[model samples]
Target: MTPMNPDADAVERAVARLTAALDEGRPVAPVRDLIGEHDLAAAYAVQRELTRRRLAGGAVVTGRKIGLTSPAVQRQLGVDQPDFGVLFADMDVSAEAEVPSWRLLQPKAEAEIAFVLKEDLADGDLDAARVRSAVDYAVAALEIVDSRIADWDIRLTDTVADNASSGLYVLAERRLGLDEFEPRETTMRMYADDVPVSEGAGSACLGDPLNALAWLARTALEFGDPLRAGQVVLSGALGPMVPAPPGTRIRAEISSLGEVTATFSEKSGKPEKRDA
Candidate 1:
């Protein structure tokens, strides 16, 4: 185990507060005032601690998700680069499953490409080509992001500490080999219900989703965690995220990839009794 940082107590407190908010299914005020200002390193430290706690609680780490890679998203968040969050097995909502809106604080949906790696990518000097070589295949994905910060008011540090505002993800079953589709050229059309909400090309994600993946590969290693084989990596958003409300069915079709769907509904107290 690595030595705990001097601000370990603060990190722990932040983790506790955020975890409680998540556990109780409620939003909390941003922790910036509580943890001090613009401490990116400390924010990441809090994230690491939070991940440790979640892992201890039987949450299996399945993959990672990159955020704020698109120019529009970056501009919206006022960030220059991308942020990432750890993905756990429990976070994987099946494409056919109906998500419970009440379980999430403030949910929104973004279309993305998910890369499944066949080999470990640990090099800090990784480039897009090297990144592509490690990818086994790519699938269409929908990232349902929820922020714990009240009213979605957050800064870079606030979000990093809040696990990149990750909530749930649904991945399409179809897999396309790297050669089968160009990540930069692929286009995505997102729909809320049957109406189009947003559309964008893969290039919108830092010129290419692979580029964002490369950035994540390098960044993860710097944080002492490396991207390993068999882990899915969400390569950021291809378009603007649409508000995901209860009873709304969302879908995204990626050119040459396939379509993925997510439906949000109110959670029921009990399973409906079905007729024989």
Candidate 2:
């Protein structure tokens, strides 16, 4: 199918609708009809404009998050590759703080490894080894992914335009060096309210989380941004995501990397129905 060529006005309208939904904690209808199904380029442009608006509104870009690196997630979404989104300062949640569930729409939780870089990584020649060398440490993380697209009925273009369906994240307090830790060997088990719900190994993330990081480094450069020092990169999920609702406590324990927890509470209002 030939992609639709959108003008500046169309992109602006799409961005405005999405940003409003995000701010009001509501789900918006799929924008494919507005942006066109095959116009991924224009979808990404909309995402960039939204990011720019968020930055202008005082949200700092702390890092980036990779999505769909796991085969399980790819299969669930019927997609074959990964996409990414920028992480803002407000998206970082404390491990001990209670996440206001009412502030989100259709939230889900995934176990992941987060990389904090100590050195800048440029655009080209990014490999797992190169990516590993640039890391400061890796922490066990829980990524709470929420979608503005109602019912999470999103195509690749839909999600990419919606910031890869990214939401808030919680990182473990403890950090581990990569010298003794192997990304592929790390095992992860997630618990909801202390009951084990899902489990997987780091290899599920594109063979290794480092590979996901390398992919993000290369892809970010293509987007005119390099992996900067001190930026936290979410390498991707190690297992399936579990539904997270108000008053639920989700915890993730990673082999050698330590554990992280996210507790949700009813802060605003009940979650709106997102299923189509």
TM-scores for all predictions: 0.92, 0.91
Model 1 agreement with the true structure over 151-176: per-residue lDDT tens digits: 99898778989999998899999999
RMSD of each: 4.5, 4.0
Candidate 1 displacement at residue 24 in angstroms? 1.9
Residue pairs in collision within model 1:
none
What C-alpha lDDT does candidate 2 achieve relative to the native structure? 0.85
Q: After superposition, how far is residue 133 of candidate 2 from its true place, in Å?
A: 0.6
Top candidate by TM-score: 1
Provide the overall lDDT of each model, using Cα atoms, as 2-decimal numbers.
0.85, 0.85
Residue-pair clashes per prediction, in order, are 0, 0
lDDT of each residue in 210-232, candidate 2, tens digit only: 98898888877776788899999
